[model samples]
Target: MSTDCTTSSASTLTRRSLVLGIPLVAAACVSPGGGPAGPWRAMSYAEMYGPVVEGQYRIPAIDTTTINPAFLRSEVSWTGPEAAGTIVVDPKARYAYLVQPGGKALRYGVGVGREGFAWNGNARVGAKREWPKWFPPKEMIEREPRLEPYREGMDPGIQNPLGARALYLYEGQKDTLYRLHGTNEPKSIGTAASSGCIRLFNQDIIDLYARVEMNAPVVVRA
Candidate 1:
């Protein structure tokens, strides 16, 4: 069965409420040209985060200027224990890695859960959904009754907390009640802000969703 993390759909809860501290520069050594200074195609920031249209929703182009340049997607060296095709999330570093074959990984900036809400462990991608609906967890509804109205489920839209795609997490046969989903909040990237789920930008999530298959290994680190 599908479960919910701590995120809510209440409009009253502004971005300011979600952010706790200044933006963390996890990729301090990354170059200013939109990604790590390496042998890349030299794609401009505009092309990487341009607007996209899926089904009927038109995802707005991200304003790269406003966000930390290091948070943008890039291919970087990988020395983790996991093999290729594994998904590894470093919540403390606000980054997610999709391990590739050549001792490299495609890294994306992420927004993670706040202090007490963060969780980490081994899990797998149990399922994938495009334009997925969102169901507020019981606890979140209790904290903000406004979300109760969406108890049934929130429709898929650009503003939906789940954004364009969602990868449901599971451990063996049990749902972990966590996800690696997309968010419309570009500013949330590189910050500890979400309730429990790992969030990527819409463009990044769409890219990740297409590459990740069902049952892909996932390791979320504390």
Candidate 2:
């Protein structure tokens, strides 16, 4: 039940299309010190998809070949201000980094908000959920009346826009109305197509969801 961006209306760009349309740069292509480039070549489908569980909802395997190698998950050197375990999102670079202890980070490609939809600031992972239900915001519904049917909420499943996991961001006591979540569209990994939320591949989100803890610091840079 995954929604296809192709079928979306041209007059009103859906959030899904926004998240998928941003161009991914090859900033990390050379790798540090001219080392072996493109870590994705060394990764296998099994490693990218992991094992399946019976009865549990599972994300469909993505054809890694269809994705840009730059968007593939890999460890990269991070010299940012965030501390270990912090999630730093560089919307301009279309990359998200989970800072590690040794000047390194688990880097994953992300789809961020478009020009006007984008925001920069600090927030905390106030909540996390797996296969979370989706409640289209009033603004989204107004732009795309077709989503009116889902005003109540869409149930958790593979077809759901939230994909396999969602990490809610909060600024102190108030919800930022933003999220770091999985997308059904893997091709969106290196784009600026989302309305405002940050999106990751489903497999990447699962990996991120496991390492991120409640109240983890998240810094989104414009």
Candidate 3:
């Protein structure tokens, strides 16, 4: 899918103002005599991926042992023009970021569309759903006959591909039929293995669902 400050009290305050941009811009905002601001504190993998009862379902905990530590959720310095609250997906890098103020972002590892199934450009979060129904596209059903059964739709559950949450992407009035959703397959994070949508860890999606608002802009890089 798609998707500053100065110095002095007046000048100093401006200097310390958090600006979102490439590393160079962020570097210039360094505090006077102070190094970079204190590092962002993120939750431990255990807590971040722990099993929790969400709604009517109990989401299972992720086994971080098999996942790369780098792919885990953390605060990162972002170098992009998107404003705060935007969702940016880097398919090649297998990462999805929620842009934060002050040249920083909340980064999460993601599984993107595989090969030819990948898509790019901009879209907006048109709708949000929890434990959403899964309706396999006709094309997908043709590719995997087994999915034909879901052509009508699949009820929400732990085994559902949409996992704990889904954010439907749209282009103005048109539905892109692409989503930023959760998956039970933690191992898929950081890989190009989806049909076209972006997938995150179940827990991560739950967290993202809560933070994102309606009509949030999304950018999926080529």
Candidate 4:
């Protein structure tokens, strides 16, 4: 099971709240560089809602082996000095860069934490997991009682929150609950969704999962 979905429709912050009765998977990602910037337009409902059953999404099987090539996108940055081999996640733009040896970098779209959940500073990828199991902390379980039933482990399936892969965040040797994971809810990308975890597209996660090794540095910023 994933996170709670108890919020009334009124509490939803989506731009397409007007279009009810259908699962949100049909919405589309707002195309950038448009005439006038307004509320985001989802590229399709599949971006968030996926395939719907009677009313809910019938999520598809997650292909852990194949990375979706569509997610390799780039956004602008201040273009600062490359401190040798380092990865930088520009919080404002919601993009992360894997610094290359020359002046180039491979950029990826990311979903950051909203407002109070935003984090910064230096850390590293302590370890990695393919179809990693999720265990919410004690406080999270307390706040959302529905999470209690999933304490043991969630199977690596389409509905799994970790998506295709997970890069565990850490400081020194301590694990920060925050993770860099792929999301079934692709619309959540380029926006904040969770307390502090960074979400990515399934294809993007699988790509990074293959490139990144243990103890890879990760720098987040405001």
Give the per-residue lDDT of model 3 (tens digit) for 6-28.
00122111111221111222321
Worst 10 residues of 3 by lDDT: 1-10
Candidate 1, residues 101-208, lDDT tens digits: the string is 667888889999988789999999998998999988888888778787789988988868888889999999988779999897788889988889999998788767
Off by over 4 Å in 3: 1-42
Q: How would you encode candidate 4's per-residue C-alpha lDDT over 128-219 as one tens digit per residue?
A: 98776776776777887787777776666557777767888788998777788877776666776666777877655654565565787888
lDDT (0-100) at residue 158 of candidate 4? 52
Alpha-carbon deviation at 132 in model 2, angstroms: 0.3
**Candidate 2: deviation at residue 30, Å?**
15
Q: Model 4, 108: alpha-carbon shift in Å?
A: 1.0
Could you tell which candidate, 2 or 3, scores higher by TM-score? 3
Per-model CA lDDT versus the true structure:
0.75, 0.71, 0.71, 0.58
Candidate No. with top lDDT: 1
Better of 1 and 4 by lDDT: 1
CA error at residue 208 for candidate 3, angstroms: 0.9
Pairs that collide in candidate 2 are 18-193, 18-194, 19-193, 19-194, 20-188, 22-191, 22-192
Which residue runs of candidate 2 sit more than 4 Å off their true CA positions?
Answer: 1-45, 50-56
Pairs clashing within candidate 1: none
